[model samples]
Target: MRVRLASTDDSPAVAEIYAPYVQTTVISFETTPPDAGQMAERIAATMPAHPWLLAEEAGTVLGYAYAHPFASRAAYAWSAETSVYVRPDRHRRGVGRSLYEVLLRLLAAQGYREAFAGVTLPNAASVALHEGMGFAAVGTYRRVGFKHGSWHDVGWWQRGLGGQGAPAAVRTVTDLEPSELARLLALPGERR
Candidate 1:
């Protein structure tokens, strides 16, 4: 599969890949599946500050990953919360891994200092993926989210992006030239 930056036009496919997780599982807390238009708006709003990436094979999107502000406070600007979703049929095929590797690299290139991921409890696959990518489990919020008539715990993991010492000015994805972004995404080898 090839990994590339996501465009607003990919929203419909992304939304379709995400709908099952929202409708049939506690992986996402969103009660209703977002439509393509909503996904397009989200892609537009997030692209300026963060990277949204997709993994595709034969022109079909297999999975996607992205990062967003970890918190609204200015002090939290160097950190981001991340999420990834793959088409159900594409599970265990490295689609999620490929997407995340590219996404994290782009985030690091854009000056993000840390990346965080939250996995709903009991999701061994997701937990393994994050840990395999070098994230350490930081903590868990017990029974924090209610879904499907039950409560679910969420485990948070963090990975440092090598940013340290005095803080540098963080650059948005929009600030990078197209060539630079493409180079970052095309880096070879799996992260782990």
Candidate 2:
């Protein structure tokens, strides 16, 4: 599989992978599946400050991962919240891991100091994935979301990106030159 920065053109495929989670599961809290156009707008907005990465094999997108602003406050500029979604057929194939590995690396390169992920309770696979990637369980919000006729707990995990001392001004992924961005995505260990 190959990992790369996602483009607006990949929105439909990404949306397809995500629609099921929204429609059939509490994995995502979004009540309605976003259309391709909405996904495109989201990609455009988030790509300015963070990365939206896709894992593909034979030209088909298998999964995607991305980071977004953790909070609106300026004090939170060095942190980000992350999410990943994989095609249902592609589960257990390392698609999520591959996408997240690249996503974390890209976030670090973009100057993000920490990355956080929230997993809806009872999701063993997602919890394992985050822990395997070095995230520490921070806390859980009990019955934080009501979905699918039930209340769900949300567990939070955090991973430090090795930034130390006073943070330098954070740079958005878009602030990098095209070649630099390409090189970071193409880094030797980034793909599965």
lDDT of each: 0.89, 0.89
Count of residue pairs whose backbone atoms collide, per candidate: 0, 0
Q: What lDDT score goes with residue 159 in model 2? A: 98
Tens-place lDDT per residue, model 1, 1-192, is 789888999999999999999999999999999999999999988886887888998999999999888999999999999999999898998888888888888888888999999999999999999998989999999999999999999999999988778778889887888888777777475231
Error of 2 at 177 (Å): 4.4
lDDT of 1 at 3: 90
Model 2 lDDT per residue over 1-192, tens place: 888888899999989999989999999999999999999999998886778898998999999999999999999999999999988888998888888887887788878899999999989999999999999999999999999999999999999988789888878877888877777776356532
Quote the lDDT for 80 in model 2: 95
Candidate 1 global lDDT: 0.89
Please list the residue runs of candidate 2 whose C-alpha ends up more than 4 Å from where it truly belongs after superposition.
Answer: 177-179, 187-192
Model 1 TM: 0.95
Candidate 1 wrong stretches, greater than 4 Å: 187-192
